[model samples]
Target: MGPVPWTVNSEIYPEAYRGLCGGMSATVNWISNLIVAQSFLSIAEATGAGPAFMILVGVAVVAFIFVAVFVPETKGLSFEEVERIWQERPQRNRGVAAVPDQKEPLL
Candidate 1:
């Protein structure tokens, strides 16, 4: 959960979109870190470090569920392979319409 959002965004895009997506993701990650660094001390002061971290733990749980449901296991998958994997899900379920399944391995 820790840094999962920070790390994963840059990894999931297709090869064609990776440059654009990676840049955007890096910006978002750094901005989020800036905001948290600036705000966390105040938040902790207003509501103790223990409670603040507990809230983050709850957020981590939610993030875990999100990843489990929405993120595919892309390990050992090429960018095209990962794209095909995600495109396997029904449009009704989420995201773009299912592309026709390829018979050849997605290298």
Candidate 2:
């Protein structure tokens, strides 16, 4: 669920920025997971496990709402269609090429 936006963004953003954005998104996700894990014991102790769990649930709800309102349906759309839509934006034109030879080949 969370990876959807990052995947779309990575596909539509400039090639040069894709890796950075993906890495940042991944790092933030991991960090958030770690924080939640590390904080769970303290949160459960201070505020009760119920409240801590509710907080996590609330975050998920908020994320769902945001996606529902802002994210478009990508279902059934081919990759080319997706790229065509993204290419409409001037800034994204370079990033939305039909063939993305963005990443360097491994030597």
Candidate 3:
């Protein structure tokens, strides 16, 4: 809904792969926007407004969880530091809890 996605996309990838990853992320973002915009009316009509809104809320919750777990915090960190944080993390522990000096993920 804001610049968070763009800002994160800019900071997260290595310089060499930034362009490719940024384009991919942008494509996915627009596709998701299109899907929701196109389907909201049909979904609401088919299921009623309360249920339709609830479905969107459920999706938002899932997305929040996914971001909290998988997205690294780049605040106050240099590009190399961000990369290092991700690289130092174990595959099994990619969540915010595993991030250095952070006990809780930003919400």
The alpha-carbon RMSD values of the candidates against the true structure, listed in the order shown, are 8.8, 10.0, 9.1
Q: What is each predicted model's overall lDDT from 0 to 1?
A: 0.74, 0.72, 0.81
Clashing residue pairs for model 1: none
lDDT of 2 by residue, 1-107 (tens): 45765666645545657778778777887787788889889988999989988988998899889878755566777656666665665466557777666488757
Winner of 1 and 2 under lDDT:
1
Candidate 2 scores a C-alpha RMSD against the true structure in Å of 10.0
**How do all the candidates rank in terms of TM-score, highest first?**
3, 1, 2
Error of 1 at 17 (Å): 0.4
lDDT of 1 at 21: 82
Give candidate 1 regions above 4 Å deviation: 1-11, 90-107
Off by over 4 Å in 3: 1-3, 90-107
Writing each residue's lDDT as its tens digit, candidate 1 over 1-107 gives 43775567656777788778877877777886787788889989999999988877786798789989888887776767777765666554554436555799887
Alpha-carbon deviation at 35 in model 1, angstroms:
2.0
Better of 1 and 3 by lDDT: 3
lDDT of 1 at 89: 62
